[model samples]
Target: MTYCKVCSLSGEHPGIVLDEQQVCNVCRLDSVGDLLVNYRYTQEVFEKFQRAGRTEGAPYDCLFMYSGGKDSTYMLDKFVTEYGKRVLAWTFDVPFESEHAAENIRLAKERIAATFVVDADDDGIKKMMREVFNRPAPRKPGNYLDEKLPCVSCRTFFVIRAILHAYRHRIPYIALCADPQQILTMESDVRRIVRGFYEAFGVALADDLFRGELEQLLFAHDDELPQIVFPFIAMRHEYDPDLIVAELKAKGLYASSPMETHCTLFPLLNYYSFTHWDCMFYKLNASSHARAVKRNGADGARSTFSLKFPRSLNVLEVEERLRTVTLRIAKGEGAAEEHEAALIDAFRELGTSEEAGRFIARSFLEMPAVAADMGIRLT
Candidate 1:
């Protein structure tokens, strides 16, 4: 039950090897001034993007992946009003989208002036998810779930689409509205990760856009790579998650915190990652927030959601920290209880493959076993 005083990471996991100082590896590995270096580099990239407007008759300067979340909503406005980039905003609606998130999408479409597009490619989404979810759980959870198998597989699918969309439209930029935690991750590894994704999938997926066409985009030389944009990183934008959520709500651009704002299946997904993988994916991002807090005093704007330590680890306890952030969500951003229904019920409604559904059901059953092994009790 040891916790890093700086970042609040548990020592149960391998990556969280806490030293005698009670500081986790996350804080220990953070090189001084890396954030500043990243800030300067991304700023320079943004400047080049500003100067490299529209690839010589290109329809738009950037193809922004707008999830109708706070970050994308704010960035959509920033690109149009401030950056003055002709944006083609794209929303890929997954079946498990939160009720509030959908409403936010509707509101944003009205307020944000951009060439908006929605792709509820249920067939595509489910097909890839089935492939990802149906895979056998590893015998031993490696590196404490840091690999984030499910999240990575799903994201690579969308990233493949983004690259394909930008290439087809001749757009030079694809903007990913990642939070600072995500922005802080190894940005350089993205190409390798995407390339490995394709390699792992092996033969073609037998789906549109996911076939072999993605290879050209990802496999291209560094100079030939389509411009990828991380808006928060590029601008070194001040991050205040609570403030962002409040502003969006005031503008009628949001539903509420947690449940309706983020993906409905978020809690379910994290549960699976924890039981089967021995770690939660969101912990990676939360660690980034922990690093920020350690370096910068708990500035009001920088204060994260309450990510305090637990007496021990279990589903409910770890899930709380996971909720502090999601994909594109920062650590300690929103309220909890994002979904009320049993996670199994929600998965049944949207989940496609029977085998994948069964895996999830079994995973939930094993949660107690996982906690028991660690001498922790599930509530």
Candidate 2:
């Protein structure tokens, strides 16, 4: 349970390495400064994007990816009023979206000058989600898998959708509003990973041609791709989460449930990670969070190791926790009513048939055995 004195990152995980001064690797990166560049953020690069995106006659300067979460809501206002950029705000309407987030989106539409676009492909998304939960995901080093692999796949879908949307509308820039702490991009594996999730359904599937087209759009050549703008990185603003929460409340953008501003699936994802990874998002992202705070602090700095800060997780602890939760759930010990509650709400939101939801639930819960049967090693 030991943690870095400076950053509070738990040492229980195999990743948190502390130097003689009891400072963490992440903290050390910030001591001299290097985190922002590692995350692919540089003043020159950001300025270049700004200069390139100002071309005349583009329908909008930026196509904002609005998730209706705290970060996106705040960033949307900044992009429009402060930066004075015309924006086409977009949302990928998923069943996993929280009611509070929906309300925030509604408020933003009424108040902000940005044009709004919302779309959903429930049938397609459901199949993709089911695939993510049903199959064993390929292991990646670090805490990459610490967040449910579905979160990665789903967010990538959101990013890809925004890119294609920008291309279609002749928008030169796409604005991503993922919280500042979520600085890393895993698109290198996402193109193939997400493609396999769909193509595995079968060749007879009607999406074959459209699927290929979507892939090309998702992984288009640099010349063909829309330049992306990471709000916090580009703006170089110090992200104060507490302040954002207070402002959201003062501005009437407060989400109803505190636990749900991010997503309804969050709890379930944490449960999955806690059971299998011996860690949850709190632990999964501690290093990243620390790095963000360091670089965005009163004095700016950046460090991601020097790379490898998240190191491998404690697999033995994960195994024991998994066995405990599995047995407790099997015996109806009421160990995870909260997790099931979120899942139930999600099913209701999706209008999923009871039988289908139950099947998904059963399969997701039995994932460990399923992975074993498929000869996939988890943990």
Candidate 3:
């Protein structure tokens, strides 16, 4: 009668054994270790970028994906001023981005006198995001690492768009600001990039109904995009966030507004991810955020949906935000509370009330275990 809590396997299934609590062996193994491996590959990637003549002998070395955030600001400064690379800065101007982020973009351009390009079509972006959020792909296996929500899909759209832009302009490389610790890969080879994309998407998504919607909305007319290069991936984890923020501010690159974000859904998505997947995204992000604040030497501002933000965001806050946004889009303003209640009721109707309750308790207990498994030390 014992059952596995993870994949829901029972004693009737093969390789099942009952533990003291009558849970199956599969669920018991969850406590053995963290599933995803941690790695530092940035330095290796950076060295490759240097050897490949990323900055020397090219008309324009690369296209930088600038988000006008503290990290990207420092990245742009490093690429152009420090590395002596000819660069074109690009921003995907999603409508949900705070006004402050937009101002930061303007400030970065002014400060660097760098050439900039912006792609600002809100309707298309919103539609694509909605489709991604609504689709249900096969749940990721426990050992396989992924973002807890579809927000990763949103990031992918931006990345693909940037690559397509680089391809159209004949740029050989597109630079991104992903830290090595974040991605766990030192791959800078174009073949690796293409293969990774295909592997992540091709088979699992081939017959997915959402694939059609994604293609229609985001990739109807596909163009060969330039190879993505992560120059920072090769640098050692020596760039402290606080130091970078301070340096940028000294260069007159200050936060344009308090509590603004380049990606509107980042906080909310992180919150949901932590809740459902036992992923400590914000904690991971907090390390970088702390660096930014220290470098800026200013009072740290909270992310839009962070508990440390102006208003403490608890589970209720998460529910309220999601309910409000979804209802505003579906029914218009002033229906948020009603919508929130309705969604909660629907969960109950689906008999997820106890499931949700258990998930919350398990997530809290499992987080430390998962973190330990991943070799991520929580201070």
Candidate 4:
């Protein structure tokens, strides 16, 4: 009854055994080692930034996505002061971004002479996100499973918006503070970058909502923005998280309280993903609190994972935020009841009912999940 650790398929299930690990024949032949090689290649690509002198550019070499987080702040400072590239700091003001994050955005603009743009269509964005989260996710059979969350959908929109901004503004490159470890080996190809959106939302979703803008944006062959580069990849060669955080803090750029994130839907999205998917999507992310602590010398032992829905957020606050988001989405989409009920049911399923609400409130403070119910497709 032994099962493969990688795929969790049965040992008796006719697969080639490799190194006594009993991987399925398909998986064995798939050459997982190739992924490591690809990662190395991706790492090399990032290292090239270090060799290329930053002074070779104008006031700014790229547009940096500034989330007001430690990584982005540090990277922004490094690019401006250390590398000497004039950067255009861009922030997407989604509905749920914390007030502190907004302040940090102001601080970043004042601290750096970088031009700033904040896209604040809170109502529209929230509506789009509610639909995105509620829609049925297409099943990707036999592949690594993805937990669908409003956050993923929200970030996809941000990237698209950023790309559109870059294309229109003629910004040569768009810089993301995404760490190498955070990106998958498969995502090295730029083509696959938007595949998740296509896969999850489909063409209809784009056509119906984005007015074919997303499709046109994705298909346009020319004038694409600069490759998304992770300066941290190169920094990894010289700096660990501790050094990076310290340097940023010394510069008066630090992670803001209540952790206003660049992405608004991260907390709720991560909460759902962790509970339902058995995947710590945020934890896997290098910028996640756990990884931040592990990499940046922050207190790793402390649960900085902020989406502790009920516990981290006061009951009143939770009710208020949910009510606000629900109303916004409802007004936009005319489907407030459906979305609200879904949220309530999801929370209840996670034992957020009054009786167990307090106990389960901080459950997401650590990753939490339900026992295996039959696999159900979540759109």
Q: Show model 3 residue runs off by greater than 4 Å.
A: 1-45, 51-58, 121-124, 136-147, 185-227, 256-259, 267-379
Mark the 10 consecutive residues where model 2 has the least summed lDDT. Answer: 303-312
TM-score of 1: 0.71
lDDT of 3: 0.50
lDDT of 4 by residue, 322-357 (tens): 444433342344353555454454445332454333
Task: Give per-residue lDDT, candidate 1, residue 169.
Answer: 74
Model 4 is weakest, by summed lDDT over 10 consecutive residues, at 366-375
Score residue 86 of candidate 1 by CA lDDT.
91
Distance from true position, residue 11, model 1, in Å?
A: 3.1
Q: How accurate is candidate 1 locally (lDDT)?
A: 0.59
lDDT head-to-head 2 vs 4, winner: 2
lDDT of each: 0.59, 0.57, 0.50, 0.51
The per-residue C-alpha lDDT of model 4 at residue 38 equals 60
Model 1 clashing residue pairs (backbone): 305-332, 324-332
Give stretches of model 4 more than 4 Å off: 1-60, 136-145, 185-191, 215-225, 255-267, 278-379
What candidate 2 gets wrong by more than 4 Å, as runs, is: 1-34, 38-42, 49-57, 137-146, 185-210, 218-221, 256-258, 285-331, 335-379
In order of listing, the candidates' clash counts read 2, 3, 9, 9
TM-score of 3: 0.55
Superposed Cα deviation of residue 9, candidate 3 (Å): 23
Give me candidate 4's TM-score against the actual structure.
0.60
lDDT of 3 by residue, 1-379 (tens): 4443322333433234556666555445442342122122334435555565653344566788988777678888888787777788989886556555676788888878568888765554565555544445335333222443345555665665675566556666778776544453224444444344445556344224133333322342332335566554445346454566678778888663222443455434433443334343343333233333434444653221111211111323333444344334322344434544554443333223444423332333233343344332322
